[model samples]
Structure formats: C-alpha cells, structure tokens
Target: MFSSVVAVCIACFLAYIFNQRSREQAGDKNGKPIPGPPSLPILGNLCDIPKSHSWFRFKEWTDHYGPIVRFKIGASEHVIIAEEKIANDLLRERGSHYSSRVFLPMAAEYLSGNMRPLFMPYNDLWRTSRKLMHRLTMPSMANSYQPAQSIESARLLHDLLQDPRNYERWLQRYSGGLIFRIVYGKRVQTGEENYLQRAIKVVHNVERIASPGSYLVDVLPFLRYVPYPLAPFKQEGMRLHSEELDLFRSLLDDARKELETPDVLKRPSFAQTFLEEQEAIGLTFDQGAYVLGSLFEAGTGTTAAAMMSFLLTMTLHPQWQEFLWAELDAVVGDRMPDFEDIPRLPRVRAVIKEVLRWRPVTAGGAPHTLTKDDEYNGFKFAAGTTFHPVQWAIHLDPVLYPDPDQFDPSRWLDPSFPTYKRPLDKFPTLQNFSAFGFGRRICPGMNIAERSLYILTARIAWACKISKAKDSQGVIIDVPSYDYTSGFNVMPKNFAFNLSPRSKLHEQVVEERYRYANNLIYLKPKL
Candidate 1:
C-alpha cells in the first residue's frame, strides 16, 4: 500500500513537471539550434522515459526534437537519428566511422567478458569477428547456406501444421535448429531439454541483467570499487558469465568431438568458418568460444523475434495476409518456395519489407560508435560518440511513411510513394532494414534469415488460413496485433489464434517437400 502510494505520487510529480516543459516547448520556441526535446535537470528527457517499448519513447522525443535529437542516458550523450535519409547518411555513408560499439561495462564484465561481439569494442578482434560473420551472413557468401536454410523452412511448415498453437515455439525451433545444423551439422527438434533453449536462456539471463537499472555498475563505474557482496550485480553478472562460458564452450566442445568423425569442419557456419581461420586469425580457443557464442545470441534471438512479429502481423492485418496468400497462390501455386523462387515473388517480398518497417525486431537499432569526428548536415559528431540508428522512429516517420502506426503494405505497393524502393534479395532487400545494423556491423546472417523467412512465410500463407480466433462474443480479439516482449529481442509476447489448411493439394505439397527436406538436416548431440 505504501509503495503504491509512493509510485502514484512520483508519477503525478513527473507528469506535472513534464507537462510544463511540454507546453513551453510545444512549438518552435526559443529555437534551440538542433532538433531535440527540452531538457529538465541532469536527467533531461531521460526522466521522460517511454513505457511498454522504446519506439514510443523514441517517437516522443522525435516529435519534440525533430530528425536529429540529442539526449543523455546518464552521463553518456547519444544522438537519435529519426529521418530515413539522415539515418541512411549516418548508418550507411558514415557507418564505418560509427561502427564501433560502446564499452558496456555491465555487459563486458557480467554478460560477455569479451565473449560476444554485440558489446565488444571496435578493434582488430571485432574486425576479425565481423569477417567470420560475413562468411555466413554476407549475401554472396550466404548463398552457400541455401540448402540448410530451405530445409529448415520446410521443417518449420511441417511442425506448425502439426501443432499450430505452438507456432511461436516452432518459429524459434526453426531458427535455433537451422543455426545448430549450420554450425554443427545438427538439428534442434525441440526447445525443451534442447541445447538451443539452454544456451539461449543464458543469453536471455545476460540480457535481463544488462537492462538500464539491472545494475548501477553500468552508470557508475565506482561501484566496481566496492566488494563483491556490496555490489550484488557483480555477483549476479559473474554467475551468469560462468553459465555463458559453460554453455557456449560445451557446445563448441561437442562440435569439435563430432568434427573428428565426419566432415564436420567442412560445414558452413560461423563456428566452422572461425575454426578454419583460427590459426590465421590468432583467436585463442576461449575467444573462439565467445565468438561462436555471440553468433548464437545474435543469430538465434533476433531472427526468431522478427519471425514472431511477422506471424503476429499476419494475424492482425488480415487483408495483407490475404493479399500475400493470393500472391503466393498465383506465383508458386502448390510448390514450395526455394532460393530461386525468391526473386519471382514481389507481393510476398513486399510483406517482408513492410514487416521490417512496421514492427521491427529492434526499436533503436544497435548503437554505433563514431570512429572519427565528422559533420552530418550542420552538426559535428565527435569521435567515440555512440550514434543510435533510431529505426523505431525512422520507420514511423510521417514524411516517409504516412500514418506510420497503420499496418499498411500498400505504402510500398504504390509506386508513387517516395520511400517505395525495390523488394529485398533482388534490388531492394531485407538487408536494407537498419535492424540488422549498418556498414561494418550489418548482420552476417541476413541472407540465411531472408531465405528462412521466405520459405516459411510462403509455405504458411500458401498452405494455411491464419486468421484471428474470435472470443465468445465473436469479437476479433486475435486480430488486434500484439507487441514485443520487454526484452532486447522484440518478440510477440504470446497469443492464441486459429489456423487451417488452405487446400487439399497444400498438404500433399508440404508432405512431399518436408520429407525430402527433413532428411537433409542431421542432429548430432552426445548421449
């Protein structure tokens, strides 16, 4: 009762304070030189943090600040880029200059301990790590995984049809299974008692610890001076770190043992790629473990998150779902979508494009570090400044995507629309989505991710009638799209929906293709 009263009081106080600032700065007022929100005390707009999601917070600031908003998160200063053109200018044109990741003290010591790339500082180590990711994720190199990507997609369709209620789990299974197979020539049939979940759970534990208030050790480094008992986060972080070391190293050890038998090392994955180049790269066994672990964290979570978002969107936006189904029906008919089929499908491609835009996996894309002092528009960014991609704000910008909140693929459908570009994997593609990141830090798994989405989305829409399950009153409860979880990976929290076979031929097409594709994946877990 006391805590509730205090919380209410605090909310009232903050609302009162913010309203005064909001009113005064509602319009082009004192005319601050740069476009941004009005500051209040040491916190600035930091006190006006958004609840539910980061996108809304970013939008709030963008509305108040314009395209380029400068703000503070604790002592650190960050520049949020909202406009698409400006975002491209910063993330693409100046990506290399701003590709370095900030030294997250909380993550480095507690989460990765130099075992992951997401938090690793930009240097020769990161560059080498980036090279390894490129071998699998870069478009040209990514083509090598088409066999694995396609097979996994077929498995995704098979599993979903069997247990539609477990669609969310199945999506993760497909992504996790594909990553495992690609990395070690193994498959993940289930997430429970499954190496993928155990490993990913550790990553999730680490993500939870790194939340803004997860530990004060992040904001105030002085806390590190305190003893372990005094700093609870340090203790927790170290415990999580140990778990990470055990999980990733255990997986690598299993793969290494398996490599002794068949042509395991010959497999195409970040792990195998790194192993082949380990001698030349000069990465120690421990470092190699972390690098592969980073791939697991980066590779598995984000892609699965996007897929869940895709499912949610399809359920909510029935018209777009219908259009995609019609497109799939017309284009592929009863056949499964393969790598070659990607280019031929335009409307399906547009759906992918819209998903990346409408409900992106990451709200504010991975923060970028400025390598050199440079000028963008009139503002000069100093070296070491971590620039935010602001994907959440940019995707919702009115100038580019009018009524940004609306789930409208028609924006891309209309050729007259200025922001309309070619669909991904061909001319315009998913790689362009800032969510995977930019320049030096672009996701290396983009190709495989695209192929995975294409195969499953094409098959799902072609085979199943995915509609929202209505409640007792016949209300369209399932149709209302849901949002991502509170965690770093933006996933559809959870929902129940109805699904059915699109046609008689659809089942045969799925069965024939899945049987052929299923045999291609080989899981090799120790007894």
Candidate 2:
C-alpha cells in the first residue's frame, strides 16, 4: 500500500508539470508571442525574479525585450508595460479590463483579510470602498484639509529646527499625524505616540508581506493550503490581521464617542462621516474599520518617503535650493509659503514633479490584472494576465525625458524639454500623474498627497538650507544616489546630511508660526 501511494504521488506531480508545460507551449491565437527572456522548465522564470529592487530588473528586461514583455512563474503570466503611452492606453483608456489587482495569498488573504481595497479584487466591495474614498478625497474636500496641512507643515519646520538629524522621523510624524487626523478625528502630535507607532507598525508589516516574492505562498498558491503545523507564515499573518483589526476598531470607536458629544465643534474626519452613515453605506463594522485603516496605511509611508527623497535631492543638489529661494523670496519674502502662493511658485511645483519623476516612492507601480483576453500591438494576452506599468522604466524613458538619469527640474520648468508644457499655472500639476498610478485603481488620496508635498517642500526650502554632513575629520560624507530601502515604497537609506535655518529671521518665523498655530481652537485638542 505504501509503494502504491508513493507511485500515485509521483505520477500526480509529473502530471502537474506536464500540464503547466502544455499551457506554456500553447501559443497566442495571433501566433505573435509576447517577447521575454526564455524560461526554464517547471520554474519558468521564477529564479529570474529579483528579491530586491525588482523594478530595476524589470526595466532591464523591458529594455531587452519590448515595452510589453511577458514572463511566467508557475502557471501565471506576468507582463511589464515599460512605455507611459502603452500603460495609459491599456491601464487607463481600457480600464474596464485592467483595473483588477492580482491576488496575493499571504498579503491579501491572511494579512489583509481581503479587506484592503488597495489589494482587493475589482468587485462590489472594492467599488464600495473606492466610492467612500473618492467621496472623502475629492479635490474640493482635499482643499478643505489645507488648514490642517498648513498647521502640520509649521510643526514640521519646528521639528526640523529642534532636531535636524532626525528629519526623516519628523517627516513620518508629519504625514502620520495628518492622515491620523483626517481618518480618525484624532491628532498625532509626536512620533512617540502609542497610536502613531501602532499605525506605523501596521504599515511596515504590510509593506513586508506585500512585497513581491516575500513568501513562497504568494507565487505557489498550493502552499497556502498547507496545514497550520507546517505553515508558520499563516499563523504570523493571522496574528497580524487580528492586531490590525483591533487598532482599527479602537480608532473607529473613538471617532464614534467624539461624535456623540453634543455642542462640540470638531474637525470633520472620514471615520466620523463613515460611522454616521455606516448602515446606509452597507459596510459592516469590520469592513468600515479596514476602509478607514486602509486610508491611513496608504497615506502615511509614501508621503514620508517622497519627502525624504526631496531632502536627499536637496542635499545632493543644493543649486536648486537657490532657485527655489529666488522664487520664494520674490513672491512672499520673509513669510512662510501658503497654499495661496502655490500658483505663483512654478519652480516649487516643478521641483515636486521632478522629484516624483526622478525617484518615485512606489518604483515598481502596483500590478493590474486583465479581466479578459486582450491584444496589444501584435501580442495577445489571456484573461487574468498580470500587468505592471513599471514606473521605474516609464519615468526614465529617454524619449519622454531626456537625460533620464539626471535629476533636472528644468524638464518641467523649461519649454525646451519634451516633458515641458505651456501655461505654467496648470501644466506641472500632479493630476493624473504616472506615479500616483493609472486607471480606476489610481490613488484617490492624490489631492491630499500633492497638497502635503507642495506645502512641506515649500516650507522646508524657505526655512533651511540642506547640505552634505561633515565627519569628525571635516570631510563631506558622500551620499549614494540609488541606495534606498527595498519595499513597495522606497525611501533613501539613512545618509549623513546637515540642515540649518537659512537666517535668524527664518528660525524666528518657524517658532512663531508653530506657537500661533498651536493656539488655534482646532489645534488645542490632543485628539
């Protein structure tokens, strides 16, 4: 009986391999194969996928192959869209078939409980979540959040002035605090807050689990069905999910309690609105909690990462600081920048755009799955084909951006560059920007994010000068241009840098503004 069982198991394994090979051999109906590096049997390009900086690898593959390159891992077909035009063509114009996300067994199933709209499949739940986010983050509503953004920007400047070495931490606090207030009707005054730390933990956990090839189960679906005794990842994921759920629920409960208070003038929040209309919105308590948590998760880290990248850029290229100062000094001398000044400050806007283009936080871009068979150019792809509109490649495309490797804000400022456009007021905007993503799945919080970047970048530039740090020997420490943390959103690895107030006036202004903002009625409450 043992011998017979072993024979049967071996036969089944062989049959599975044969089946996968058969599918691979089956050419597209059009007889034009999508170009890619040749794959090995069974593994099928699995070994070729990089565990870190996958976007750079994807760019190389796309350059060697065509813009639309295809490769297989197990039975899955993955396509990389290198060109912005092609990405826009399929992921945007034909969004109906390409908006869905590829499922990850570890991240989406066990960790997220299929509740994170960012990773959820295109379905009723996703639609409902998207609608809620859209309602909260529309341009008009985003504009309403500017007062909060401004206050936080002032706090950011104050934090940097007090402790410049921990600028990264302060940036994280700024983004976390802003999103926490917007999502839960509470405040995160410092990075040391317990709730803020909990939220940051959640973001870090998700980034780790969701990173491509983080777990074997993500690529091999069958591993997810393994028994608990053999699958420790399953246990870890469930524990994380439970912890995240509790935190989200607690935040929602707090929001509910605040709303119950009568005659209290409170800043409006997404959680407050959701709790008030939960029944009408048709989401359960858990679903609503995750939706709000998702917003906080999405907003916090990426914004901080972008801001950090901005600091890195400034440290490496201090010449741009003079250009920004020129604009700021001419437009609103001796005063900190406000939203009103954004229209007149094209250089500030261009710098933000250029930073996003230069080193996008989500360098790989999110994966989109095709819902039905589709043909692009001459190649045909079947339903469930995964597509990655690689931001690393698209942003660095030489045709669209000359001297693609150079960090040139002039691309947006000067008309000589191909990316340049007329009418500076609106042309350098982040609307429909490739970094925020494409199609129906595009980030809904882009309005809030753009505003945050603008205000924070402008304030930092106005108040201080960033430069390379000097060691005990008084030699400037070199900063690596491409050394970044590996994850869904990448930030520059810790590097030596110095930040100081440009003048005594700038220091005094930051102090006065922070104190004045704190005295406001809305800012008085810790919550």
Residue-by-residue lDDT tens digits, candidate 2, 217-268: 6766666656665577899999999999999999998888888998877666
Which stretches of model 2 miss by more than 4 angstroms? 1-26, 261-267, 523-527
Candidate number with greatest TM-score: 2
Give the worst 10-residue stretch by lDDT in candidate 2. 518-527
lDDT of 2 at 124: 96
Candidate 1 clashing pairs, residues 3+ apart or interchain = 36-65, 97-371, 137-444, 187-523, 423-428, 424-428, 424-429
Estimate, for each residue in 306-354, the C-alpha lDDT of model 1 and write its tens digit: 7777777877776777787777777777676666877777677678778
TM-score of each: 0.87, 0.95
Residue 55 in model 2: lDDT: 92
Give lDDT per model, in order.
0.69, 0.86
